[model samples]
Target: MPISTYQVKSFAFVVREGSISGAARRLGVSQSAVSQHISNLEATMGAQVLIRGRDGVALTPVGQDLFQLADEYASLDQRIEERLRGHAALDRGHLTIIANAPQPALSLIARYADGYPNVSIDFTLFDWSSAMQRLQERRVDIAVITEPAASRELYIRPITQSRYVCYARRDDDFAQRPVVHLRDVADRTLILPEPGSLTQRVVSKALADHGVVPRRLVTMTSFPVMKEAILEGVGVGLFLSASSVSERSLCEVAVPELDQVFTTCAVVPKHKLGLRVIKSFLDVLADSRA
Candidate 1:
């Protein structure tokens, strides 16, 4: 028997949304209906495609293979619906976006929202590792990432470039210097983002290469927290230049060892580039760059 498009679409939605109930809501069907479709899909393929867990659904090896084709089909279907709807399609839609940094992602989203107010957006901030993992899993419609790994499956466009810098309270002696060596901050209490973040990775490599180590380390979950910690005299913070709202109490200091420029890019699954919402967002990105 031939596989059904509906079954494949249901499976794709489950992967994209991360849960069957979420897929059901998107499909305007009951959760049981989505489950039955997934079951039927597995039976037809003669292999289990998904593993359900408390967190959400994960694709099995077979499911991963099937999803590429399924997602393309789903995207095409969406494109067709949008084309049939004409200009009205732009009036409302949904997009899922993830990012590692705040500047470009949040700014781009703000611009997109201004132009398409009715289009709902779900935006989340993630560390580099989690953001890349979600991008590879095809779970998000778009990701704005820093120094994204090259992949044929992804379509990437560079949005902006920046280098890492150290953040310190304005009154701190280090802030008075035009530039600080990695060694200078090594002896101070260093505040860094979570382990898998790009800032942590770059700082770790530079420290190892220069044979420097901080006297104490404080790990922060995000840029805002790191900034707050720095202001509170907890420690000096490391992050990309202009990653957060600048405060008069804080100053950015250049670290020549960490000066390697990093490019932040807008990324999307190549197969999904044609989807209306994704394309529309990319258009907004282009407008911003212009």
Candidate 2:
């Protein structure tokens, strides 16, 4: 009689997962059952495979060879089942996307939602620092980040360019100013984004370049909160141009002399591309902008 496929699968899973307990959890069986499966496979082959250590299992030379063979078999099985399943389901997957507050990334996600009603999306709003934190922790599956950060384990894809704009309340006295100079605020109060955000950095550098420091300042990260600060005459706001759009209450102030624009990119775990839905959404985002 041929060896059972389940036992061989169990054996392969243990080595890949690095322990009997992990394999058991993957297989939804007891840890002892996983160990028994490995033992049975070793007995059937009349050769030792896993070299058991105090803490975990390691593959021997023969075990490594068999593990590769089993991996190939599993890959083939997955492909066959997926291909046989035919049309992909439109609805029924969860997508978590993180972006700086009210940026173009939000527009992209909204466009996708309009087309695919069944697929659910969770949108997280953060300043740049917290967005990077969520990406590193895998709290968000997709991240729209500024300036395209690179990490050894992450894949970053640049999708678009953005820039900072000064915003003031539509009816405010400053709204009629043809162009506001950076030095104009030297004696006035200002509201800034959280310290670590890209907008905050831009505003800080601009002030330093002009050799004018603000006398009074308020720092907060939320887009809506910053809007309130500007409207209430707390100070001026230097924020991403894309975030201030679609609102009649705020007016954009552009300074061409500065010639500064920030880029927003998408990032995800490199190995997660193997999953179909993740790959498709990435394609859609790239296509949406193109």
Candidate 3:
């Protein structure tokens, strides 16, 4: 019998994740089922593909060869399925998108949800590093990030651009200023995103360059929490201009010294661009601004 796509997928997941259990968890299948798929694939191929040891599963020489074939096969499967869906005029599919910045993806997702009610989307909020790593590993179909470094391995399309802005309470002494300098807030407590976030890195570097440090520094993971703290007079917050939209109570101050502007992009593995769903979404994104 021909090896099923499920069997190949299980094998690929095992190779990608490095364990039967990891593959099972990723595929949402039982460990026994994953093992059975591997056993069947090995039998059909008449070669050992995986060696299970204390560390994890390692691909044999033959398995390494098969692994490459499996990646191509998986990519082909996605293309075929997308074509089939197109021919059937079925708008139903699952898209997994991991992003750090919520801008354009959130807007695009809203449009997609309304247009293709049958399609489901899995959007995960991840740090910048995890967002890039997952896209490189092909774990997520799409990634949205700010000012990502250039990479030939992936295809990146810019969605929008924004500049860094300072958020402070309306009644604060510096709130009415046209431009707020780092020195103005040097003595005040600062609220920012956690350490690994791109926004925090930009703000920190700008502060360090100016030799300024806040009286108190607070890092929070949730954007709403950071906004609430700023509104409640906890501390000043640095955010992208897009994040400050519709926020009437807080004052938005531009800092010319931190002249860095952020560009948000949608990144995908170049190999997976042939999928119709991905292509359609990219089209929507492109047309969105027009």
TM-score of 2: 0.67
Q: What range of 10 consecutive residues in model 3 has the weakest lDDT sum?
A: 84-93
Q: List the residue pairs that clash in candidate 1.
A: none
Per-residue lDDT for 1-290 in model 1, tens only? 67888898999999999999999988789999999999999999899999999998888999989988888888888888888888554887889999997778999999999999988888888999999999988889999999998999999999999988889999999899999898997689999999889988888888999999999989999887888899999989879998876689999999888868899999998988877788889999999999
Residues 101-150, model 3: lDDT tens digits: 56667888888777777767878777677677667556677788887767
List the candidate 3 regions with Cα displacement exceeding 4 Å: 1-4, 13-32, 38-72, 85-88
Which model scores highest in TM-score? 1
Error of 1 at 196 (Å): 2.0
Error of 3 at 10 (Å): 2.4
Arrange candidates by lDDT, descending. 1, 3, 2
TM-score, per-candidate, Cα-based: 0.93, 0.67, 0.80
Ranking by TM-score: 1, 3, 2
Question: Can you list the residue pairs that collide in candidate 2?
Answer: none
72-189 in candidate 2: lDDT tens per residue?
4543453455456642764445566878767677777877777666767777678888888656544456888787467875788887776676688888666788776777667778
Cα shift from native, residue 139, model 3 (Å): 1.2
Q: What is the lDDT of residue 271 in candidate 1?
A: 85
| Superposed Cα RMSD, model 2 | 8.9
